[model samples]
Target: MREEYELEVLERYDVEVRSTRRIRGAFFCDTDRGTMLLKETALSGRRALLLYRALSRLEQKGNVKVDTPVFTEDGELLVSSAEGSVYMLKKWYQGRECDIRQEGELARAAKELALLHLELADSAEWSGGAKTGIGANDSTVPGGVLPVGRNPLDEIRRHNRELKKVRSFVRGRVAKNEFEYLFLDSFGKMFRIAEAVAARMENSGCMKLFSESCRRRDLVHGDYNYHNILMTKEGPAITNFEHMHVDIQAGDLYYLTRKAMEKNHWKQKTGQLIVDSYEKARRLSDAEREYLALCLAYPEKYWKTASSYYHSNKAWLPEKCVEKLKLAVRQTDEKYDFLAKTFGLIL
Candidate 1:
């Protein structure tokens, strides 16, 4: 659409379009309407329309502070042209994304997340929708009565076989020197550690802890990273609620802390400030906190082992790929250490 036409659309709201760009098929336009974000999609237009309607309901119910778009003369949140593209507009929010490295940003963001959760708890349902945590092995869906096609243990055995093949390939092609040998040694040890942790969890009653802890289903921002949050002069303003879902609240905490530590910000006092602030706001039970620690540990184990294998094999790969893989391995180790210290899990 031309700038004039966009302006005409905004005229209903008594606003003027200043600038526009096609972002992911949506025109994100700067307008007197306060940073209007528009989306135009062909395949997902209907889904987008549903989402817009949901957002509208939340805004009307005072459950969310979203920009409710002004409807056209026909009173539709979506406008479909003959070209099959559906258009949508929303008021753009203004603020800088909180930096995870900043001292108080994580804490403030965590508190804001807790507040959002509390607000969501007031209403039994949210308009956007809820997600089911169904994995490939989940047998609760429509054809669930069938016997298991492949046991999870069998899958694990197959994966180990594949890993052995990859290890042989790496050793034959790249392990001609002492450095390569040391890398392979570390890789093997890390894999053993991962297996040990998984085995211990399976045998130790930790699975029950995980199951019980995950039973508390509340609306949580599935991707509550620092980048999705805005640091305003007033306080932290959350954005991008599109990935919101009903899940264990600790998952959100675990994800944010993991990401923050990846940026090397989790080692400092500022990182602890964020964690403590979030804890104060949400007040997690001791059991929940312990579960979070265990949840954090599993990722570290997998990443460390995977990184060692990939980096060791990278010697035989392209130079550019090796460089990138090495950097990623370093970052993974750093994050693992940071989280381990933060949660007081040395192993």
Candidate 2:
């Protein structure tokens, strides 16, 4: 019923829908205005406006194509149905998801990401060292606003504690499963690596870097994996800025690099290609480089798998968990080698 109601919601817009197709959890509508997508959203009013504003700003930049939100006839970014369901429409593009495995595509995506950072920086520019478009309470502002920046160092420390907690939980289990045994086997080494990386990050002046970046109001595409990027004929059309927020811009690069490397089995050339392509547009400062290397050094995959296992059903463990554990463990050597050769770090 809600799905059918979505079409009615589109009537709020002036365009006449000629056809509608469902794909990737979104409705692709061929409208009189152009291609548009309608999808249900749980975004709060503030968050929805934030995304709309960010994408609108990006749309102004000629080269950066984004799926900016389309306002309703009543000048609302979101429209509600009879049952209180909310939906947002956007100007969609004709394209497919970027293929991360292809080297050329990967390189193009990296460069495109760097270009995006430049635009996000421009949109988030600060004046006289004072922030803009940010309010005391985000809900108070309707024009949309960027949130306060977060320090990655704090997150790293918290993750470290969670890693220990998961380890203790697994150790307390007398009748351990295969995943538990493997986690125990790798816990000591992975923990040491985590600690070393955390210590290095603390001393790397990253806090100062983060503070300055926040003052500058730098923004990152919070979720920058391949799925968000569309491979259009014009080029990579970056979409979905919902998770976009103020943070160290390099964090986005780190995420893209890590995800691509993981898929390529921690290939050194792949890592180098990504960094090189990104550096072509925006170069990483010394501190940013160190920050990125340390971030990649931590056993994030290992921690995530164990954390998932700890919180899931223990009696009937999924086989995929064991496979993921083995893969994470097996990739340690390759990951370390890529880190050392590509970033010149020996941890």
Candidate 3:
């Protein structure tokens, strides 16, 4: 595969390649044109070509600063090799991933993301593809606000049953001292929260709020983590549109805050920094802020999702994993109160 890619590039560009190194299934090479990043994937040549074209369009519009691909003599953005891999080359921008702790970096990232969203919103010509981030309904109880199947409530009831089964499994494991009591206790608390939230969702009028909010769709970088943002001398440059999708602006905010909060290196203040920056740049409404608060209050959803992954593998996870879950639960309770008080939702 490497040799084939090398030959294809050699035949196309007529430039001498100096060295090649593989990083995350993509090849980084030192060539006469400077450092080039080449990605080879099993994706069809047409899809790869489409992405390259989208990147090209974004670069042309000054929305992104990226290495443009060197097209083949036949004007193809992607070339398929006989070995079943599509390959393309791009210019490598020199910069490190932004440090969440850096002064003004979080605010800068927020503003940049807002700009990207605005650029992608309602632009018919920018039909690069669908957005790719996580959605609110992804974790909702099967039969909750967003429809999952023929009956959403039935799905929630089914998940409730699974939760009960997990509780029983944890109880048995704890009795044998195979799992720590604290772990079981924490899981029990999370399960209760999930059940309560599911019930509220089923009986409350919050669905109206969610539906109204959904109408305000914008282009969101589904996964707006620090790693995907680059801190260049000019400013923060956004990259990795792999998870880019059209969704509520709140989804982007929720995922960004959640990721920052989960990081061990950053202090609690880091989460605040992101929120402050995002709020300043985007000017979220009081209602939008409350919605964000609601999302944070439901830590059980995240736990349930993680537990699914953990149980699926049945592998030993780090002690920190359990600690993080517990911390998230504690923080969720505190955040719920803080949000309620700030918004006068309880008073």
Judging by TM-score against the true structure, name the best candidate. 2
> Relative to the true structure, how large is the alpha-carbon lDDT of every model?
0.54, 0.83, 0.57
* Full-model lDDT, candidate 1: 0.54
Any runs in candidate 2 off by more than 4 Å, and if so which? 124-142
Alpha-carbon lDDT of model 2: 0.83
| Model 3 backbone overlap count | 7
Per-residue lDDT of model 2, residues 177-277, tens digit only: 89899999988888899898888888887887777677566778888999988998988888887787767788888889888888899999989999999
Number of clashing residue pairs in every model? 2, 0, 7
Error of 2 at 331 (Å): 0.8
Clashing pairs in 3: 67-91, 131-244, 131-245, 132-244, 132-245, 143-152, 143-153
Candidate achieving higher TM-score, 1 or 2: 2
CA lDDT for candidate 3? 0.57
For candidate 3, write residues 123-194 as lDDT tens digits. 234443223442434422111112111122344556667766766766665333333455465676666766
lDDT of 3 at 39: 73
Candidate 1 accuracy as TM-score = 0.64
